[model samples]
Target: MHSERASLGLQIAAIGGLLFLHLPILLIFLYAFTVEERTYQFPPPGLTTEWFAVAWNRADIWPPLYLSLKVAAVSTVLALVLGTLVAGAMARSRFFGREQISLLIILPIALPGVITGMSLRSAFAIMEIPFSVWTIILGHATFCIVIVYNNAVARMRRLSGGLMEASADLGANAFQTFRYVLLPNLGSALLAGCMLAFALSFDEVIVTTFTAGQQSTLPIWMLNELVRPRQRPVTNVVAIVVFAVTFVPILLAYYLTRGGSETAGGGK
Candidate 1:
């Protein structure tokens, strides 16, 4: 009876936590349609779609959205390439200080975002690099590389070395061995990593703020809107769009990784 009661209590606590986490998002979507302006009164007077149109028509929002997408795409590609190289070296090759290098790759991500932002800002300034889209990409890439590296490393660890050895023994060059033996195994992981990196780069604000000058991303735009209250409902519209754009890809990436995990485990 005590165990049953404890389990019931734990389940109730979990439900409460979930509701606490998502209730505000639910409220945002609900009151976004509420006809009442400015004040958030329960059971809004009426429902309206005006704010959705208003948010879509805003000229200021789209440019930032486009810029963010471009930065995210470019940065994610760069991170994937760089990260894959690092993951491959760490996972497959015996090198000096391999463990240290692996830790170094992950350190930027484990560090506080503010610290990373500050460090990037200082580096850019020291290098005489002006704040621009490139700067934002560089800043975002620091953390984004960790995502790709992690995914690639996990997949590489699960992969057997015998496959690559067999390919090489069959008279394949390094490039061909990697292409035929490793690349096929890594495809899903790389895809998942790229998607996750893109999502992170898209929504990153702190480092972008430190790196971007007179440039804004979608996340920055959202922050400005929240600070200067306009049609509050319009914020919700932006939120919904941003959430959909970012979360869908992330969810897909997660499920892709989960599939990899299952496949690897099944083979074991």
Candidate 2:
């Protein structure tokens, strides 16, 4: 009875914590449809879709959105490929500095985003590298790699090695075995990792602030709109669009992985 009570209390606490953390986001969504000019107004006065139409009509928003989407797509692909290679090497082989390699893979994500941004900025300055969309892509890839690496490593660990051995014994070459055996097992994790990386890159602002010059990604555009005097309500509309855009990809990724797991189980 004591343990059950404790567990029940813990569940309540967790729910409370989640609500607290998400309160601001909830408010953003709530106010997106608010008719009031200011957010501080009580009960939002009324609700309207004017700001949504305003946001849609704004020409300035599209450029940043396009840049962000392009960079995110490129960065996520790079992260997936590099992360999978790193994960494969670390998980499947024993070598020198293996522990160090793992640590390096995780280090960028563990450090504060500001610190990562600052370091990248300094590196670019020293190398005389110009800030552009490519720079943003590179900056985003640093932490994005960690997400992919983690997913790949976890899935690789869970996968059976006997299959690889069996493939080898059956005269399959390394590339053939990897294609037919390992790739199939890694599909779900890779898809999940790509979605996560894309989401991270899409909304990333801190590192982007340092690396981007003259180019504004969607988040950067949103930040500017937030600080600007006019179009305040329009910012909320952009926020709602961002939430929708990101949420769909995330949901698709979730369902894909779930489906993959079910298929894997059925095969078993």
Candidate 3:
């Protein structure tokens, strides 16, 4: 509908925004392969594949990487189960204070990261809970659950209530109706939600900072590596890994939900 000149301007603006956001990430990729071990060089002095090998062989990196994977996996599972249940209840039911409850469910994510992190730290302190891997999982799950719940509740709201009534009339019990009817309809949404949750949990740092006492996840490891002086290229290589780990799941989630509508644009 716009004039050709206007459209060109819009396209150029969008490209510029993208470059502004992603240029730093691209810089990390460039430096990952650089030959310099200490200070960063402009137009990297040399490039090699050696950092990937170094990162692979780095003994200290593995523990944090393994912990991150484990925490993310567990947190995502928790989010999928709890978030789906909350979404189903919310989308299907009407009751007093429902809006308030909905706000509370989303509050963890709506709050600033620092606020959430501080509250979690304080809660753990009051409860006399020692910081550990489980604490990290709990912290990550708070936000991860919100992501899954947003996806699931949106999808659930779009589904026809008549489908459930029809299932009931067909002599299916609640469990059978859910298994045969709801699960199939909600499958892609749940998968997409879980993928998003996993990616978020895998890279979360602020909440992890409060919850991970004496332990390090991959992000925490990267933060520490940045502060200290070691083979900086190896840290960049790990950053590339972290980026890939988060980016792939997020990209997959986008694809899974791109057609989330029952009708075109129905769930947008």
Considering every candidate listed, which one attains the maximal TM-score?
3
Local accuracy of candidate 2 as per-residue lDDT tens digits, 57-164? 999989999998999999999999999999999877899899998889878878888988999899999999989778898888888888888778878887888989
Question: Model 3 clash pairs?
Answer: none
The total of clashing pairs for model 3 equals 0
lDDT against the true structure, per candidate, is 0.83, 0.83, 0.87
| Over 4 Å off, model 3 | 1-8, 261-268
| Best-first order by lDDT | 3, 1, 2
lDDT by residue (7-29, candidate 3, tens digit) is: 78899999999999988889999
Q: What digit string (tens of lDDT, one per residue) describes model 1 on residues 42-69?
A: 8888999888888889888899999999
Candidate 3: residue 242 lDDT (0-100): 97
Model 2 residue 71 CA deviation (Å) reads 0.7
Q: Regarding lDDT, does 2 or 3 come out ahead?
A: 3
Better of 1 and 2 by lDDT: 1
Q: Return whichever of 2 and 3 wins on TM-score.
A: 3
Ranking by TM-score: 3, 1, 2
1 or 3: which has the higher lDDT?
3
The CA lDDT at 72 in model 3 is 95
